[model samples]
Target: MADEDLDIRMFVDGKGPPDIDPYFTEIEGAEAIAQSVALRCYTPKGYAPGHNIDAPNDGVFLPDFVQSTMTPHSLFTAKTLVHGEARKVDGVDSARVSVTGDQAAQRMTISVEGEGVDGEFEFSLTVDPSGLGVTST
Candidate 1:
């Protein structure tokens, strides 16, 4: 994900108790990258929308995550990077980037918790090490 200008930015795109949209905007973004990830992701029950590069709200957003929330980070594999926003919940900043590796195996979940976020679970996404056009809907 760190080549020259490519990156996956995490942020909240929607707000409604019943629904929220997480936007994993591609820094130096690419649409094909998002398409490729859609082909591999195993969206579990309750999440069944469509994958449209131009229509982010139509699909579940995918994001590329790092091995560490700190600096000098090692990029997680595309298969493992879960892209989502880091925001405050009750003053605790938290985020979870993950993937459902195997049905039998526990979902590969990385908890990114720190200051300034209210700890709560809304919507989340995980992206692989792709290019700049991958945006999770």
Candidate 2:
């Protein structure tokens, strides 16, 4: 990688859970060199509405408003490097970036001594020059 080609930046757009919008703000403070990319990410959790039930007056007393629990959202990011030449076919140059991590949206159910969320989530990101486009075979 050439020193001028190396760069560090945050990807601004991606596909993920609905309502969870991700926007790349800026790249981390580092040297911008060819084949070199560095960045940090911050993700916020989506807010949900809570339900409440209530009863009043003489007769009988009922619980007023139901208690709700909110789940915390986490963000997992990875930094990777690509060392390969761009493939040119049909007058187009293409490259690929692969990202491996966890899918923050997959929720799992768990019932042990107490109630908890459990599940397996896999994150695999492939950035091709031509997204979802037919390749020259």
- Taken over the whole model, the C-alpha lDDT of each candidate is 0.30, 0.19
**Top lDDT model:** 1
Give one digit per residue, the lDDT tens place, for model 1 in 6-119.
434322331111111245555432322333223223332234323223533222233222222322232344323334322211132443454333222212333332223222
Tens-digit lDDT track of model 2 for 14-84? 32111211442332112111101111111111211111323121010000000112122211112211212
Best by TM-score: 1
Candidate 2 segments whose C-alpha is farther than 4 A from its true place: 1-10, 15-24, 29-125, 129-137
Task: Show the colliding residue pairs in model 2.
Answer: 5-34, 6-33, 6-34, 6-35, 52-66, 53-65, 53-66, 54-64, 108-118
- If candidate 1 were superposed on the true structure by all CA atoms, what would the RMSD be? 15.1
Q: What is the TM-score of each candidate against the true structure?
A: 0.21, 0.16
TM-score of 1: 0.21
